[model samples]
Each structure stands twice: as structure tokens, then as C-alpha cells.
Target chain A: MARLAVDVMLKPEILDPQGQAIARKLPQMGFEGIAGVRQGKRFELVVEGPADEAAVERVRKIADTLLANPVIETYEVHVLSDN
Target chain B: MARLAVDVMLKPEILDPQGQAIARKLPQMGFEGIAGVRQGKRFELVVEGPADEAAVERVRKIADTLLANPVIETYEVHVLSDN
Candidate 1:
């Protein structure tokens, strides 16, 4: 089995209120010298079949279809070690 | 600058309500056959000085101090391709 690593993040231009709240509270939480902390989602899938172009397509279809909100968010894929 | 990739996620056993809601809503969004989509945060940091044991220590300290919540969450560190 191979793994497809995906990261779904809010666009930088968009205002990330959740991230902002976290960043605002970070300093008070005793986290000194930290500039910013943006939170996002990562998905690792146990994929089947040959680890080839086809696999990439299927994985990305999953991303485009359900994994990401293309309007407000974006995603990136990383094909990691396969078995 | 080198990058230290860290995955900050909710503990496995913890109730990932957000992820569960996402997984529930995914299929309806035309993402068929997606069993689950657990949500997490990945941190990529650029550090100076030597990438040695000290760097690792400093990085983990950041995790403990501000990056991760010890009580309800956990985090993992991955030293990815450095520049």
C-alpha cells in the first residue's frame, strides 16, 4: 500500500479567524518568540494499485471532489513511500 | 534555510468532531468512496545554525512550550528535505 499525503489550507489572502484567534492567544499561553501559527488539515490515504500516474489522478480526484473546498481553500499532494 | 516539518494533530482516541463532520459531509459533496478524513496541522519551520541534536531539542521544546497541547493533543515531528 502506498500513502498519499495531502494538505488542505485556507488561502493566505483570506482571513483565517480561527488561526487569528489561536495566534492571538499563543503569546498568552507562554509561547514566546513565536511569530505566527497557521492551522490546516492533512490527510494521509492508504492507496492501492500501482503507484503511478493513475494513482495520482485518483488521489487528486478525491481531493478535488470531496477533500477540499476549491473556492475558499486549496490542497497539495505528496506521494510518500510506497509498499 | 532548512525546514522541520511537524504534524500537530488531535490524539487518535480523542473525538475528532470536526473531522467526523467533514467525513460525514464529504460523500454528499460528491467525494465518493472516501472513508474518513482526519484533520491535523502540519508545521514547517526554517531554522538557522547547525541541524543537529540541539536543533531537535529546540524544535521539540517549541512543541512542548507553544506548538502542542499536552493534555488533549499530541504532535509528531518530521525533518523534511532541508535547503
Candidate 2:
């Protein structure tokens, strides 16, 4: 089996309220020098195949269609393992 | 400024309904060879400082306390940039 990791994030123009809330709380929690906390989603997929080039490409397509909203979000896919 | 990437994932023992829902839909979407879809959270933090060892350490501490819940999730932090 192979492992793939996909990260989905809001576009730069979009607003992220959850991230905003976390940023607002940082100072209260003693982290005073941080800013722009953008929260996103990560998906770890274990596919029943080798992590070949073709597999990775197919997973990327899958990520674009099912794992992310193209209108407001973007996604990055990585093949984590070939085992 | 520097950027830090933090990935938070549920413990293996915990349930992930969102991931399961996505897995269930993949076959209908024509992705039938993938299994074990686990969903997590990703946070991109732009800190107002250099990405030095001290800054990365501080972010790790921040992740442990505020960015992730240690009770049910595990978090990994990486320094993505120094500029």
C-alpha cells in the first residue's frame, strides 16, 4: 500500500473565521508575535497500490474533484510512501 | 517574518466521521482503489520573527498548548520559511 497526503486550504482572498479566532487567542495564550493563522484541512489516504507516478497523478485528480472546493479552496497532494 | 506549518491529526484509535464520509463517496466519484481516508487539520502560521531555532521551538510549544488538543489529537510542526 501507498500513503498519500492532501492539504486543502482557503484561497488567499477568502476569509477564515476559525483561523481568525485562533489568531485572536494567541496573545492571550502568551504567543504574542504570531499573525495570520490560516486553518485548513489535511487528508491522509492509504491506497492499495504502489506510489508510482501514475498513482500520484490520479490521487491529485481525486483531490481536485472530491477533496477540495475549487471556488474557494486549493489543495496540494503528496505521495508519502511507496510501501 | 517566517511561516510555520502545523498538522494536527486525530489519534489512530479515534473515529473520523468526516474522513469516512469522503471515503464512502470516492467510489461513486470513480476513485475506487483508495481506502483508509483520515482527515485532519492544518494550520499555516506566519510569525513576526525569523525562523530560527528559538522561534520554531516557541511555535512547537504554542502548538502543543493552543493549536492542538493533546487529548485526542497529535500535532507535527515544521518551519516552512525564514523570510
Candidate 3:
């Protein structure tokens, strides 16, 4: 089996309130020096084949169509393993 | 500046209905051969320092305390870049 990863993140221009909330709480929790934070989604897929270029392309299409909202989000696909 | 990533995922033994629902919908959406899907959280942190071991350790601690629930979830930290 092959493993692939799809990371979906909001556009840089968009406001990420969730990330902001965490950033705001960091100092209070004694975690300092964090300039910014952005929260996103990670999806791992176990597919029945080699994690080759073709598989990456297929996963990219899947990410574009289902995993990410093009209107405000973008996605990146990576092949984690081929075994 | 340094950029770090913390990926928080549910433990393997934990149930993931969100992943299941996506897996169920994949075939119907013309995406096939995906045996399983696991969804997780990805946090990107821009810190005001070098992305060294100390930064990684700090991010790991932040991940453990705030980004992930140690009871049912686990997290991994990676240094994306150091500038």
C-alpha cells in the first residue's frame, strides 16, 4: 500500500480566527516568541498502489476537488511512502 | 524567523467518524483505490527565532499542552524553515 498526505490551509490573506485564538493564548500559557500561527487540516490516505507521480497527481486532484475550498483555501499533496 | 509545524492526529485506536465519512464519500465522487483516510490538524507557527532543537522542543511542548489532547491524540513537530 501507498501513503499520501494532503494538507489543506486557508489562504494567506484570509483571517484565521482559530489560529489567532491560539496565538493569543500562548503568552498566557507561558509559551512566548511565537509571531503567528495558522491552523489547517491534514489528511492521510492509504491507497492500494505505489506512491508514484501518478498517485500524487490523483491525490492532488482529490485535494483540489474535495479536500480544499478553492474560494478561500489551498492544498498541497505529498507522497509519504510507496511501500 | 523560524517556521515550525505541529501535526496533531488521533491515536490509531481512537475512532474517527470524520475520516470514515470522507472515506465513504470518496468512491461516490469517482475517487477510487483509497483504502482508508485519517484526518488530523496541522498548525504552522512562525516564531521569532532560529528553528533549532530548542525551538523544536518548545513547539513540542506547546503541541502537547495546547494543540493536542494527550488522552486520545498524538502530535509530531517539524521545523519547516529557519531564516
- Winning candidate number (TM-score): 3
lDDT of 2 by residue, B27-58 (tens): 99888798789999999999998988888888
Candidate 2 local lDDT, residue B74: 98
Candidate 2's displacement at residue B69, Å, is 1.1
User: How far out, in Å, is residue A63 in model 3?
Assistant: 0.7
Ranking of predictions according to TM-score: 3, 2, 1
Ranking by lDDT: 3, 2, 1
TM-score of chain A of each: 0.88, 0.94, 0.96
- Report the lDDT tens digits of candidate 3 across residue range B1-83: 99998988899999999999999999999999999999999999999889988899899989988999999998889888999
TM-score of candidate 3 to 2 decimals: 0.98
* Backbone clashes in model 1, listed as residue pairs: none
Ten consecutive residues with minimal summed lDDT in candidate 3 chain A? A58-67
Top-DockQ candidate index? 3
* Ten contiguous residues minimizing lDDT sum, candidate 2 chain B: B27-36
CA lDDT for candidate 3: 0.92
Query: What stretches of model 2 exceed 4 Å from their correct place?
Result: none
Error of 3 at A40 (Å): 0.4
Q: Give the poorly placed runs of model 3, Cα more than 4 Å off.
A: none
> Looking at candidate 1, what is the lDDT of residue B74?
84
Q: How many clashes in each structure?
A: 0, 0, 0
